[model samples]
Target: MTDDSAALWVNGSVARLQGMPDDERLLDTLRWRLGLKGTKEGCRTGDCGACTVLVDGKSTLSCLTLTREVEGGSVTTIDGASDDPELKRVSAAFTAAEALQCGYCTPGFVVALAGLLKERGRSAPVEELMDGLQGNLCRCTGYAAIARAVALAREDAP
Candidate 1:
């Protein structure tokens, strides 16, 4: 608990947050200090994908991520992805497909899908798409619609 270890900038914005004790959660800092609410804290223990966000372009659970570790890297949240046309399309497809129920975990799913779709491109196969989204769990509508939406968005792309 030193005065030097208070908070720092994340991505490009200044974040005034304090890391919890060794056992505490980082999700609190994200929600409170950074005002990045896109990463949800479904299961604080890291089982649920609800707290997922991007760390260096990889999807990770913000609940378990320490703010200190994030200072030197890029952390992209669902809110950050909204600017991407592909992500916007993914979001629209998810909405049109009705892939969400309570909407708690949709942010994680969308962020993960953004990474998957961007890296895999529109030519990816169904199996690859399924594998990419394997970690995102949706308790609402069947994942078929979600997957279909992603696939359709891919096909619709030039």
Candidate 2:
């Protein structure tokens, strides 16, 4: 197969990457090539959500997303989200609520929560919040803290 090259905005910088295989997953490219390790690899499939990232401001499974597909698009990993005020609020809420335990799933949860709040609004109902978070799985911490974190973030969101 022939290798291709693509340019994408990652974090806050534009990255020009080369020698990409057609099937190269976004997670692999981010972690191995771009050196963004915060997006973890869990199930490899889309189910785990451990490799969650924001593509054009939407939460996406990097493991299932092809690198070439994201060409010329914006990709935001946990590293990038860390600097976002909205995501910072979410992170503070997560910390205040003690929402994470093992922390392997924290990045996914954070990205997912950001997407949820962005889509559903800050005052969305509890059921809606729960539904929004269904894509992510956290084995160590029960969802109660996470739910509380969302509520906290809602209270603080503009």
Candidate 3:
């Protein structure tokens, strides 16, 4: 009965998300079909980063990713980011600096920071860092503290 379903590979496990015709709503599947709840559901329109996850080693909006599109790709969540050194640094810095107030947008910022640190390296200027983090929005902190957290994280990056 389950043989005619597409398999989604996530967090080193393969699960078939049934009822999805074209993998279009995989994010909801991850929350509903699977038990991975770390990835939150925010703006379903992709405007918010609450549903952010790493697809193929890059930060992507889970709300926008189709389950079929990521058939063979590796999906990494906040739970998976703990092992990444750069992400660890960012997490620590965020905590130390109190970068998050409401914390709804923190995960997305961390994920974005990871991608930026990976692509731009550790020496990115503050301005560039600000630009890189523009996509992830935080309404509670006014962004100054978050920016400082990223700066400290970059310094702590090896």
Model 1 TM-score? 0.79
Candidate 3: where is the Cα deviation over 4 Å?
1-5, 16-20
The Cα RMSD in angstroms, rounded to one decimal, for candidate 2 relative to the true structure is 1.7
Using lDDT as the measure, which candidate wins?
2
Per-residue lDDT of model 3, residues 1-158, tens digit only = 23346776676676766656664666776777787777778888888777877777688888988777787677777766676676678788889888888787888888788778777888887788789777777878558888778778878542
Task: Give the 10-residue window scoring lowest on summed lDDT in candidate 3.
Answer: 1-10
How close is every model to the real structure, measured as TM-score? 0.79, 0.93, 0.85
Clashes in predicted model 3: 1
Looking at model 1, residue 24 earns an lDDT score of: 37
Give lDDT tens digits, candidate 1, residues 1-158: 52345555454455554444444355766787667787787878777677877777777788887766665566677777556676677788788777777888788888777777778787788688778787777777467777776666676742
Candidate 2 clashes between residue pairs 3 or more apart in a chain or in different chains: none
| Ranking of candidates on lDDT, top first | 2, 3, 1
* Tens-digit lDDT string for candidate 2 (1-158): 53455788998799888877788899999999999999999999799788998898889999999988888998888888667776778888889999888899999998888877777788888678778889899988568888888888889542
